[model samples]
Target: MPAARPPGGVTVRRLTARDARALTTLPPAMSWIHRTWGGPEALARSGCAWAAFQGDRIVAVACTYFLGTTYEDVACVTVPDPRLQYLALDCVDALCADMAARGHTPSWTCSTSNRPGRLLAWTAGFRPEREYAHYAVGAPAATGRAAAG
Candidate 1:
């Protein structure tokens, strides 16, 4: 299904399954869990994603999910083509509006060195809280002990 455009041809409604295939082509770092777990079918089924399009092409995409109590993590991807910058911001605005309406306070996290993502999140109402370190080890085939052992 095509996105429902706004009166002034600005905002678009929530994403649908039709957008899934296109989004899958985005970089995995951007698509994150949506690419790994919920392919287009799951995106269509869950309806937790949205896109901003120009003409018939999606310029920006965002997939959001609840992390736990009181936290929702949003992953966003842009075409990275300079021509699509405005559309990317539009998607962010639309997504923030939708998240606010749903009573979910949104937060975004990226490695401190991830300059672009940090800048974008800041522009979209996210603020830097504190710096923290993260470590993870892949699970061993034989051990199920949380992958840290």
Candidate 2:
């Protein structure tokens, strides 16, 4: 299915390297492309970024990180403006369509504490899958040494 036409004059399209600069202007929270993916050039190189635009202004972004050939981890970020939040759904639709064309299943993890993220994932056709506890080990301690004890 094609992406839905946003209620306003918004449009959705695949993002390119040129879109990188605009992404920097986004609020820090909404600019994960830069923080996590090394900016738009790297994201475009990965070939899995899309954006919702109101004229020339970017309102939302969606990206997928492929896991081997079978699954894709999806993520999205949107402008803080509540009025533009709906654009995220359009981004999700577009990302799903792209994943379908590539023969991959798309999935995302939302923190149990993030009600909004969980709701959006559910609304986008994601079902509850197996839940696993997540564990992280921080960088090595000082003294230029690493110890787990």
Candidate 3:
């Protein structure tokens, strides 16, 4: 497949199992890619992960980290550097395109508190499919913060 070239000369490409080692260097904010996929190796094994590399550094990643029975989930991450603005977005768009070509209906999720994640998901064309709610079953009244906390 053709690699995606984002601004600033970053190369975005689909990852292979052999590329697992490169994922290990993802910044802490992007660690969920490893956690959700059961490690970098398993993520690569999914055959649906991609990364944006600035030279030898993996500055961003977008992957189908969770394959669900109903819908697929994509997780994205990038170095929080302004110079890399849109780098993560480009990686996700490329990965999502790959997912679409495979006939997968991919969805994006984020901790309610993650503003950047929400923005990226929206920027990638994902709208809220559902807003989840939890029940306390008549417990004490809650504070102003809901799931967003």
Off by over 4 Å in 1: 1-11, 27-33, 137-149
Q: Best candidate, TM-score-wise? A: 2
Give the Å error, residue 2, model 2. 13
lDDT of 3 by residue, 29-124 (tens): 667877876888888767788888888788888888788665678888788787778877877888888777877888987777789899888877
- By lDDT, rank the candidates, best first: 3, 2, 1
Query: Higher-TM-score candidate among 1 and 3?
Result: 3
Q: Which stretches of candidate 3 lie over 4 Å from their true place?
A: 1-5, 134-149
Candidate 2 residues lying further than 4 Å off, grouped into runs, are: 1-4, 34-36, 137-149
How well does each candidate superpose onto the true structure, as a TM-score?
0.72, 0.81, 0.78
The candidates, ranked best first by TM-score, are 2, 3, 1
Candidate that would win on lDDT: 3
lDDT of 1 by residue, 1-149 (tens): 12234324344457776766666666666655465345656864566667766555555776665444556677777777764555555566676676777787777878888988887888777888888998879874664676556
Clash pairs (backbone) in predicted model 2: none
For candidate 1, the lDDT comes to 0.65
Error of 3 at 104 (Å): 1.6
Which window of ten consecutive residues has the lowest lDDT sum in model 1? 1-10
